[model samples]
Target: MTNTNNSLNSASSKASPKCWPILPAAGVGSRMQADRPKQYLPLHDQFLMDHTLRLMLSYPKFEQLVLVLSETDPYWPDSAFANDPRIIRAPGGSERCYSVLNGLRALEGMAAEDDWVAVHDVARPCLHHSDLDALFSAVENSAINNTGACGAILASPTRDTMKRGIKQPDGTITIDHTVERDQLWHALTPQVFRYAELKQALEFCLQNHLEVTDEASAMEQVNKQPLLVAGRSDNIKVTRPEDLALAELFLAQSLNQS
Candidate 1:
């Protein structure tokens, strides 16, 4: 669980607040219907999380990366990154919010109050570099203007025709109305926020019994509106068996472009 002394330490000594990535990989991922957690599942030749970690570590040089995993998870010891010096391990919690919260708590002594913490989903292995640039630029610009109170996230505007469904007594789902898609956006990770702000927000939600679907939702519960930085639609979360193929394709395309 100890962070290795590396360039990350020197990087954090800079004038600007450093960015620390926290990946909550504790979920069972029941939708994937796999023997192991979706993160541990193979994508191409490497594990899905291997791709995500590589993408993240390649860009932003950080003090350390925090990985929240189930204490009883047997797959992590076999991962390529298991012995990496720059990564720290934290105990997983029951839910996504709890996992994220635990990850934040793991940084209590190491992270400064205003340091940025990007809470990313480990299942999202196809996040593009351009999206990360856009998100970081927006948040840093806002900080310079003293307007980044709510932080920011990479999101894509809804493209498909939206539908609102209602369940019937017979267990059938019927469309209730056509939802307006103009203002809707699919929230994606690398949801960035100040360390203290995000920690407090998640704590507030958990203590109040509020539902926190993501970091932004937790901030929203505390009357904050996070900026939605437009990102590539290809940045998808591998949730089902079919998504693995799609993720692999996207990853290959990203590599070719780079």
Candidate 2:
């Protein structure tokens, strides 16, 4: 078994910025067509959210976890982590950005301005420990390099040939043009940002009515470019029903390797 405490202590000694984890679990999984929220669905005989929570909790560097849940979420109480003292509840908002902001707000008295907040998706249950380590390393390196980067996010360079599509009056879609995939990347979770910087960027976006897809985008709107740290492809977010099987497979494979 991994020595969680030792790992955390090692990371703390090397990493200059303290890190905290924020999980947004307010979505209803509309595309999943499931009876319950996708996070509440079963994965390896446990709630999907349970697996995600355990993964974050295992990281000893994190002082606490801020979980954003919908106000009326009945399944949250049933979660195995609901009673964990390390986990704090935050009221969910209408949009992902709002939910993230709420989670950040909950950290008011606890986290310092320069502390790093790693915002991860609750549905992504297969985040590898190596990826987490890499993310923290990248952020620390940026500070050492004086890159002026506000934060960092886990991302994967696009592998598939890209295309832009256009729909005709006949309802047939055709490629409008080929998109250059060289610089494109699929943004993943555990996006880490300095607490104060992230909060300011998010608030700026909200005030201007800008669409904040991810924390990186919000930072971008404020003229802050966040570093993209490459992560493993296995770190997939469970959206549709079909993704559950793949997540289970990845989790099992990861366990075998460990």
* Top candidate by lDDT: 2
- Residue 161, candidate 1: C-alpha displacement in angstroms: 1.1
Model 2 weakest 10-residue run by lDDT: 10-19
TM-score for candidate 1: 0.93
Each model's TM-score, in the order given?
Answer: 0.93, 0.92
Q: Tens-digit lDDT track for model 2 on 146-220?
A: 889888999999999999999999999999999999989999999999999999999999999998999999999
Q: Which ten residues in a row have the lowest lDDT in candidate 1?
A: 1-10
Residue pairs clashing in model 2 are none
**How many backbone collisions does model 1 have?**
0
Query: In order, what lDDT does every prediction score?
Result: 0.90, 0.93
Question: What is the model-wide C-alpha lDDT for candidate 2?
Answer: 0.93
lDDT of prediction 1: 0.90
